[model samples]
Target: MSALDGLLLERVRGLWETVSGVPVTFPPPGSPAAIVTAPGSGLCPPAWVGIVSLGRSALVTAPDAAVARTLRQALSSVPDDALTCPDTVRSVLPVAEVLGPATLAYVTEGTFRPVPDEGDVEHLSVDDPAVSAFLEAAGPTDAEESGLAEVTSPVFVLRTRSGPPLLAAAGYRRWPCRTAHLCVLTAPERRGQGLARRVASAAVAHALTAGLLPQWRARPAASRRVARALGFREVGSQLSVRPELAHRPTGVTEGT
Candidate 1:
């Protein structure tokens, strides 16, 4: 790996280590996956188990020591590359419901290939009503998945010069280790127009200008394509798995 790649990898390792509250050292290539237990860590939706893999090294985190031990034993024979695969995880932990097999990508200023703005890109508050309306039109699944509403940084938006409507918007939340976790959304009808690239470029440029590493975590092929177009390197994968016992209903139903 180049020095720049090594530096970026260390930044990401530090971020996950902080979030998981445990050392997140990746095992050597072709080695058994390393496992640690870190309950209540920032695994989305409070997963019982989480796995992250960089290059050929992988780390598995569980909720407790016992679970970690079990996972270690079960996964000892699995290849590092297979650690993030849902089926591979589910085979060993049958009760696990996987949350993501998202690709973890990062871009450095030296590597960023920004797209030119197709229109005026405006910087707006995260709470802008137009953003909310745009998300509403995009639907709950897209809104939640985009994470646009949760960004702590200024939202970059693209719109028709004559109107208040948004064609696309992007922003980021500052994450541990000087990382900017990006959130981008484009109107469904406005997709394929390169609006996502435009707004995301603005957000990425802003993050880079502030001396922060830009992170793009994506599961969708289209989203990954945009990140690749902007020169983000896909370095790893993240998967969160919730065991059946941990699945609790928010509202209990009475006996019928």
Candidate 2:
């Protein structure tokens, strides 16, 4: 994990090798890790903000504890008048367990499972049509916000005997922790067909094959179903952090 160190830029290879067919990796190394960094594109925030793909996640650490704290401040330091996403810390830190004030732990660890049979379906592609369909079914999809870096990644699709399968999509990011962020979609007409569960199982299969983790933002209605089918446990709640304390100081005693 020291790959977040300022001096280890060259040593840190991109996670593209294990990433899903989503565009979640950093576009390219813009900052040398020795210079100022642009947001969302570089591996660092202000100075270092690592951007992992949809099916992936990232962590950045300063050279030492002091710098890490400084980096933390930069992330949580937003203006009261500034408009921002609730999740925007805008800082650099390896995403550890759930932080203070966070509703639940977003990162979950589990063994990659197996993909079920999807005869005549489940196509792998550089541009995933399946993933495209998946997002349409799953609201609040980030398929559009995907930076150019993500559009260039690989994608996969899964279908059932029914015309349009219940799920399709791509990964934007992936990491050794086995965490993946992808557009998990279910077909509009395929609800209650149990296709999503199967497709999710297939993704898990691919994950096990690649030695990675298959993570999904299950629709509220489908969350319980997907979790059970994929052998995923409710390790913790995946929360949307509140914006009120978005810029609050870190280490102020988390989980209060």
Candidate 3:
């Protein structure tokens, strides 16, 4: 594998270790990398490189060899344009080959930094009655869902001092290798007020206290800014596709 290819493979391996709770060894030359886990490990698809690790010792499916080769080429040939959002994944894999419905996401990580002004954010218990209300108001987010499914702790949410309504919320899911996936969402009306950064900083602070590396996967410019302000650096990009579209052909357009 080329250097770029090795880097991409390492990215996925780190993610797998986080989610799998087992260290991922490099695949022998030309062999598929693998992981083993007990039930309830919470490995899922649409993660890095579109592979899922079942709790057992096997992968759900390996990438198509042709697709993998294409991706290797894409990673090796970075474009001159550096002013791109969601840069790395697209450089390595075309959307057309991703098929189904997919989204481009920016994956970032950083050493923890604490923000002094966290407002009146509370460490919400999972069973806190207000959590349901908050979710109802925030609508359904992948962050909230992941917290519900995989996190043992309550998510953190910023609330007004008097009324206790949510201004922003931050949560994380555990991964192997002392990593945590961080997510933050601010109320639509409360955006642009730096509320997101405050809550996210609090969450990152907590993750650091626990000795976990926080992973921030954001797609929006505003969210990316918040991540950067919290001292996170963009390390990679992720492409998430619906399972139904995983088998579709690339280089073909609709109505073609």
Candidate 4:
């Protein structure tokens, strides 16, 4: 198998096993060059797949063969090395072919590291006025507010020592398969001062304390850097499908 295949197999195998409650060995030890697991009902979250090799082995928890076929055709053209860059996951998917009406997104998976929290960052309850203000005035748009609303835990925000204004905030919510999904937001104007990492580290440290495996799904390089600073490891890339209309390819598809 190619290196990409091996890497993807390692990541998805564990995830598949966890969700399906089944023990499986990818490529079944020296048999064929390809192994595709038959679809099972136990798989949760409908479907999620990752492609590291064109056809060596497909890492999938697909609901049916039709979806799998479309996914395969779409990803067959992806360069093996492209999967290494998590940002390419979105562009590499054959969204129209796979789900037709649904959208597929590429997201980076990250794991948290155990660390001591910086004592200075303040913790805010879900309804704290500061959290509200931060959500309202901090980001240039309402995206940050929506994300913060999804978080199930108390928000952790870092403030400017010079005043009580928000610098950054981080929190977590339950993700598929019982993992903690972390979200971090920094004031657009105060981005470069290490505030993102500071707030994220606090949230991650809290998550670890709660006996949860913290997951960081990042797309931006800056976000990835903050994740790494909080000691989260880049595990692999994932394809996230949702209920949005996918853009159709006008004619035959182009570059990989």
**Number of the candidate with higher TM-score, 2 or 3:** 3
Off by over 4 Å in 3: 1-13, 16-111, 141-150, 242-256
Q: Kindly list the per-residue Cα lDDT of model 3 for residues 154-199, writing each as its tens digit.
A: 5788877798677777777766566777767777788899888887
How many collisions between residues are there in candidate 3? 2
- Score every model by TM-score: 0.91, 0.43, 0.60, 0.61
Per-residue error for 58 in candidate 4, Å, reads 5.1
User: Over the stretch 1-256, how does candidate 2's per-residue lDDT look in tens digits?
Assistant: 2422322222222332222122333323332112112233322223222222111123333323344344445544432212112244423323332222211112223433344564734545544555545554455434343221252224445555566643444333564444454334454566566655555565455555664544444435464565565655332222211122334355543321
Q: lDDT of each prediction vs. the true structure?
A: 0.84, 0.37, 0.52, 0.55
Candidate 1 residue runs with Cα over 4 Å from true position: 245-256
Best prediction by TM-score: 1
Model 4 Cα lDDT, one tens digit per residue, 182-212? 8788888888888877787777777777766
Please report how far candidate 4 places residue 204 from its true position, in Å.
1.2
- Could you give candidate 1's per-residue lDDT for residues 1-256 as a string of tens digits? 9988888887787787677767666667778777887777674455478888887877777776656666766788888898888898777665546778999999988899998765589999988899889899999999999999999899999987798999999999999888899999999988988889999999999999999999999999999999999999999999888755443233322221
If the candidates were sorted by their lDDT against the true structure, best first, what order would they fall in? 1, 4, 3, 2
Give the number of the best model, judged by lDDT. Answer: 1
Candidate 4 accuracy as lDDT: 0.55
